[model samples]
Target: MLPLAPSFDTVGWLTRDLATLDRVVRVMLPEGSRAASGAAIPEVLLSVLDPAVVQAFRSAVALLVERGGFDKPDDVELPDVKATYAAFRTVQAAEAWRVHGPWLTEHPGSVSGAVADRFRVAAAVTPDEERRARNVLAEARGALRALLAERTLLLPSAASPAPQASAGGAEVDRVRGATLTLTCLAAVAGAPSLSAPLARVGGAPLGVALVSAPGSDRSLLELAGALVDETAVP
Candidate 1:
């Protein structure tokens, strides 16, 4: 409802099962999306994730190969995830400031300290920084599209396990930065991404993500459903 950063905001629904999720997606998204030719687990992101996350992802991939009979895709180089996160944050802050700056100014002392602090940072984003970020985003979009034209790009949903609610700001920021590095790719590229909760780390659900080309929402959903179903069978 609120436009914190409208560009990356999506209309999504929650469903308990793959069939229900498929139904919801079909009802919401238009038909005629193309299917991905295959899936690839890109290793570029491993550098930014915690060792636990990396191990979980690799274990999940192994299961996909041994149980699901899925082929292991060759390791391929990808655009820098950290750089993409930086560019995404810059653009997001600039846009957030554009949308909420006037309101905040008119209603001083309305928002909390953390919110105020974030808005201050958003407010300080320079025009040149925004321009450069946009350029980087454009390049990232193209690169992602090319890489995912027929193949689905697979990776971990987050860089690490969930942090404690009472964790300090610095620790939270560190984890958030690493997470944004992976998530920013799909957002910047405007592509479809599906996170299948088929992996775990020390009992915590560690989602393995599947990213496909733009306009491939239905296809991506189908792929996710198939994978989930296959893994669920006895």
Candidate 2:
């Protein structure tokens, strides 16, 4: 689906348990792969954290420190995230236009209203904008990869727990903004993030995301499994 944007696009699974996912990673990666570990994990994506989400992360981090014997995570300097997000969006839209515009134009009637509008926006992204966005992606990957060379990153999977099924439009938008804020860090950096389902609010499940440099998918999965095992979360 991401022809022009293949550099950043990847495929993975979502599940109820991290251990099962870890086993799948074990089978996929080459033998003798080792998970990376170190102090000084740079944490990000706090601007969108809901109160409940914040609490869940704090609890999860405490568990990790107590059980895994890791130091508490501290804030690390990062580049302009808003700019990074804009760059990712530009590149993604440019590529989406290239990959999906032809068929969508031929069968315009088959597309949903919102999706068609998105395609229209993609079809309008300028080449200059795409070039700038690609530069931002490269610089971001370089910076984040250096930060993650020996340490992992921690973030919330979403801004908050699952919204009530009856949530209104404004509420849904709020949730989406928060989710994008946290998720784009990994996506734009072309890293793999393992979702750890260690949080609950109002009896609904949520996740704390653990992200690492590219090529560390196996390590991320294994670390997530250990977090679950130590805390007996899922």
Candidate 3:
């Protein structure tokens, strides 16, 4: 459901088994994989990317190549990745403001303390800043479209393995930028990205994500199914 933000919301599945996910997604999207990419895999990286996440991603990419007949992942260059993420941050937060500002004003106590504070930042988002963010998005998306036209980039869904329930708030905030950096690539580009349950680190699930050209949602999902069929989960 991409109601508040349709473009950024690619079809995502968080299931125990990606093979079962294939059956359900194909039924829902009803799209074939003929047009799905057959190009060399390109896995973009941010400087802030954690080594562990990179290790897991490399293992998954290797599996995709050895078993699924996919190409090896290459390093693709992105401009000002940190800036790209910040721009997306502005765009999403501004959109969130429009969705919740009025409701929150009338019902102040409906939201939690941390979220309520974030809403304040959203409230302060200026129109000029949003326009600038849109410009950044436009430029990046054009380059990204050309770069990913025939390739898929692999990445980790988060900077680390799954977070513990009892982790500190300060800790979460500290690593928040790295966690969102890779995911924001697809978000800002308005492209399709699929997060497959491929990697496990520290006994917890570590998702391996794929980013492709815009409007490639079904193709991306097809690739996800292919990955599931090829790679052994355990």
Which candidate number has the best TM-score?
Answer: 1
Instruction: Give one digit per residue, the lDDT tens place, for model 1 in 137-200.
Output: 8887898888888678888988776888999988987887888888888888888887777777
Worst 10 residues of 2 by lDDT: 32-41
lDDT, candidate 2, 66-124, per-residue tens: 77745777677676787887887788788888887888788868777556666787999
* Model 3: lDDT of residue 184: 81
List TM-score per model, in order: 0.91, 0.87, 0.85
Point out where model 3 deviates above 4 Å.
30-46, 229-231
Residue 84 error, candidate 1, Å: 1.7
Model 2 residue runs over 4 Å out of place are: 1-4, 31-35, 39-44
Alpha-carbon lDDT, every model: 0.79, 0.72, 0.71
lDDT (0-100) at residue 55 of candidate 3? 74
Query: What is the lDDT for 166 in model 1?
Result: 96
Candidate 1: misplaced stretches above 4 Å?
67-69, 230-234
